[model samples]
Target: MLADGGSRGLLRKTFGELGLLSLSAFLFAFSFPSFISVDGLWPLVFIALIPIVPVIHRCSWAAAPFYGAFYGFLSYAVFNYWLTTFHPLAIFIVPVIYAVYFLILFPALKAVDLFFPRYAYWIQAVVWVGYEYLRTQGFLGYPYGNLGYALYKVLPLIQISELTGVWGVSFLIALIGFFLGHALLFTFEYDASFFVSLKVWFSRRKAALAVCSVLLVGTLIFGFVVMRGSYDDQRPWKVALIQHNADTWKGGLPTYRRNLRTMIALSDRALAADEPEAVIWSETAFVPGVDWHSRYRTDSERYALVEELRNYLADKSVPFILGNDDGQKADPGLPPVLSDGRLNRVDYNAVLLYENGKLRQTYRKTHLVPFTEHFPYKKLFPGFYQLLVDHNYHFWEKGTEYTVFETDNGVHFSTPICFEDVFGYLSRRFVRNGADVIVNLTNDSWSGSVAAQMQHMGMAVFRAVELRRSVIRSSNSGMTCTINPDGRLTGMLEPFAEDYYIGSVPIYAERNTLYYHWGDWFPLVMLSLGLVLLLVGGVRKIVLRKS
Candidate 1:
């Protein structure tokens, strides 16, 4: 007992819980997009959470939640450093929310570890995935830092997203970290080297190792096979995506006119090619409401600009698609705000499609970026809400529909405006409802960070795989590209450059993927199974104590 105490003391002295927590936080920070670079040290993610496990395993139950909270806040504070550019207060809000998340999460994890000692690691991994799923739901759904995204460049491994909606990949990686964490914990307890401890640990855990290996190998083989699976129902498709290189933040008729001219110039260049079916512009590319100005004509300058754009589209042979505000009569609800005078029109972040010089279809963005685009707690947090408004943050009315658009040429697609593509379920819903392709129109220029742009672009890879539909991201100021059904990126335009990419996109009329059919089932199942196991563990503990 005295020797055991000495060993444990030495372990704590050599690497304290705070030290391990800081190590994990730094690893977690660098594992995603940070100031380091766009394509971060992604390889570190495989073992990123390994150090945290010992901190989790050894900490007193009272200390577990605080340690977890600190880890969460520190990790995200570093990873989401770019959020400071989004808004000064954003950095605090995001990390504090994560801190609160882990405050609750770690205690539950510690409980499971205490009760289900043998299967704790596996169950904890499942819980981690469940946490991710829960976090990315409803108004606060932010999908950055998801473990699966680190594997965006590893095409073969991430093909599992088509099966499990990125949650499966999270589970696999988390499980690997748990196994490695256990080995590290052994070394710490025994004062032995990691390699010797890992070898000893591996011999005792052959069954778990085999299962994990089989899963890893199986997914790789599946990926290779899926990559080879040709889309037999594909058709010849061509679309032009324009990057006007204009700052989306700039306003007034002067900035709008300059942007419009830049786009028209870029469009002319694209139109010079074999007649493309459609030309796409980034989200909110045209700041003025085309619909409102064309009819209201209340502001002659804005109205004339809208007419100029309409005339340009009318003269073109191809369908014109661009993001603009769609103003409709307001029947607004939560986060109440004033409508435009007696016009009473509430504007939505919307995409408009022009066919034969007439407006053919419109897809209003359903998923709004949480505080920046749509805030719901106006009455409850009026002062804070006004502060957001004071910070030059404007809000839009949320459009409540999964709108699929069809062109005059018989092609069908959905424009998931901006970060809507980050949510797999939204893309799945679009595919299930007959969107042949996913064209994400985005204005990432406001962030003014290429690392931020790359991080945003990376998530689109999974959306393509999950639905087996092609994803074409058209962004203002960066990352205009098409991701094929197999999660391959091609025909990319230079970021922040005045350029355009005309891709001969292959329209895959392939059947929807498993992820589309059963959307987010893996995470749901893991959450449900976790609750059941925890309940069972509680009952067993009670029975054992009584006996």
Candidate 2:
């Protein structure tokens, strides 16, 4: 009877703690762009994870992993709920997969807390940043929704991205959250006076707290200095971005034609206002078969549409950077067999530059979306490829080169198609290869959510700040805007609106940034430190066992 009562009591306690952890996860999720739409609420991110810290500290090491996994599952599921609009299956699968990440993360973090109890706060920051860096690696690496992105509106705080990439900002947030959590736990949970609790906390964590304070103050001062520096003397070039809110996926041929004409009309209206040097279009704006090579131009319907756009550009006499499809014939050496038993010719999602109605430069999309664009390990599983084909998925061949386009007026830019703009290293590569500005062509029509578009645009802002280059983003559904070198959003177009924006972006002659030269070194160093700590821990266990 006593054993049964004890079992029930333990279960009740477990459930109660789980409820508090879930609340913490909810707070964390709400700190992101979707739930907390207002810019000022960004500071809430510093306290979002505080609730989870007590739960972690109170739980046994064996139970800590489960708590961490559950927290991750709840947090990511809420933050990424918008993905369910595109794929209902993702609601279950995405959270489960992301939860596995925290399963590994919490155990490692628990080990740190056990080994270095005194410096747990600082070590926790390192572990969290290391995990974030790991999340951005390889085929499944998705760096979206990192805590740093929440600080996009807090421009001065985010300037540290130039030195430490997004990982540094995430580390600062985690450090502050841990410190505050410790203070709260000491005061309320331990029944101590606030001043006494704070004093105890400061005495125990003086080194970590002092170092974090120095870093915070230094970063803010550096950001203020950088913000005050003038880039006004740089040459400015006027550019027009057009957005035609069309359901390109569902609305068949008729919808495509209407969207194209609407884009042209909007461009015409923008030109009437003032003749811009170049007019930009969103990704996949035209029907397929607009390749630079003539051999792939066999489809008459596609050819006619391409001709119409070319004639319009020629008449306007403005250089156009428009997104379309390009193709090349299958190589005799090696070619993929299609679902229809035909030799697969390579297809590319590309952006083309047109001057006087003639194709001048073609930049194919390099980083394709994981599942939607191309399956990563298809060669290992033929059945997966067949399943994708059965569902009418169009997989694209990855482009090889980092191609840059030069306008007639000698302005240099590189176009990162779709969500490729989210990648910091990819954008840095372009700037290193002589790109003065970063132009992104994207189609966010399928999302059908303003929050998704805004979230995407927010990440792109970091790219501009990291490279000190102007970023021009033209999206099919919305968020057609210009981000200046300082990461300020200007000339923003409304989502789901058929409109255009004309803005002058400064083109600095010199492109110099520490991040542009040394990419993601902060995260790399954190990852290395984590590995060294693990090695040391393993060695210590071995030494103790032998003794």
Candidate 3:
């Protein structure tokens, strides 16, 4: 009977532990994007403190998985919910992968505590960040909703991100969590014995306090440096961002013309004014794949559109860059039309740059959206190709190389579409390729929520600092703005509003940053430390038993 009662108590404790995880998830969801940023309740982040309190007190190794999984679900559900709009199955698969990371993280934390008892929080924070770093590395580096993005509005706090990449901001936040956790859980009443013992033993409070003070001071110093940086120059460049509110519901060529008209009209008005040197448009604003404008049997309709666009730019005497599906040339070694007549070819989604009333250059997107642009492992299961079609998901051929275009002033530009700006490597490459300003042409109307837009915008901030190059983002459903070289938002357009927004982009030659050279080093070092601790713990256990 006593044994039975003990088992019941264990089950109850497990369930309670799981409940704490659910509360954490709820707190995270509430404090994040849609609710916190959009609703303007910035203090909700502190409210999230409620759930984090218990985790520090007892340090639940077993509950870490449950908490991680729960928070992962809540995170993706709200932030990447746009994935589901593309394909419903993604909603399930993504969260499962995210939850698995949490599962791995929690048990590992418990194992580390065995060796680094007093410094478990340090180990835990680093290991967790290392996992996040790994997620942004190789084939699976999806760094969406990373805690670093939470400081999108707090430009002053995130200036250190330029030196450390997103991991720097994440490290500070994690350290704060560690110090708070230790403060809540540890039992030390400052007895005379304890006071004397302090001479021999290091106090966790002193160490945590020191780290916190350093971080706070470092952040302030970084902010002052960024603010005083050259991006604060007030030189104006009469820039224009065209909002072509295209309908994603329709497919094929008919809707493409309608989308072009919307962009063209917006461009006409943009040029009607001071005739800015360059004007930007959202992704896929034009369809140049057909026999349109090119010398090879140009269609009358295409000729007319090109001529009209050229004339429009000539009349305004300004350059325009827009997103379009410039279909591919007949390439050998690639498959022809499938049995369903869906061209297995055609590299869609290319950003065409028109300068001085002529097509100057085009930058094809390199990092295509997973499942949306390229199906994962379609070669393994040919059957999934049909599943892609049934869901109306478009599979565009990936771009082979990075291309940058130059303006008359010798300012080179590279354009990334949609979430491509979120990829730090992609932006870094642009800067490496001699791009003065990074222009991202994206269409986020499908997201249908301001929370998702702000989150997307937040990720762009790191890129500005990473390359030390200004970023000009032109989006269809809001958040069109220019980020200075120091990651400061100089100007912004309102969300869900349709109007031409203009801002001057500071042209600074890309300079090398420490983070741009050696990426993810901090997290790598921490993960290595965690692994070493675990190994030491295992070895010590064996030696003690043998003794």
User: Against the true structure, whose lDDT is highest?
Assistant: 1
> Which residue pairs show collisions in model 3?
135-141, 136-141, 289-327
Per-candidate clash tally? 0, 0, 3
Taking the tens digit of each residue's C-alpha lDDT, what string does model 3 give over 329-369? Answer: 55545444455755544666788877766677878887787
Instruction: Give lDDT tens digits, candidate 1, residues 425-493.
Output: 899888888889999999888777787888888899999888888899999887899889888987788
lDDT of candidate 3 at residue 364, scale 0 to 100: 81
Question: What is residue 382's positional error in candidate 2, in angstroms?
Answer: 3.9
lDDT of 1 at 258: 92
Q: How much does each candidate deviate from the true structure in C-alpha RMSD?
A: 3.4, 2.7, 4.3
Cα deviation at 211, candidate 2, in Å, is 2.3
Model 1 reaches what TM-score against the true structure? 0.94
TM values, all candidates: 0.94, 0.93, 0.86
TM-score of 2: 0.93
Better candidate by TM-score, 1 or 3: 1
Q: Mark the 10 consecutive residues where model 3 has the least summed lDDT.
A: 39-48
TM-score of 3: 0.86
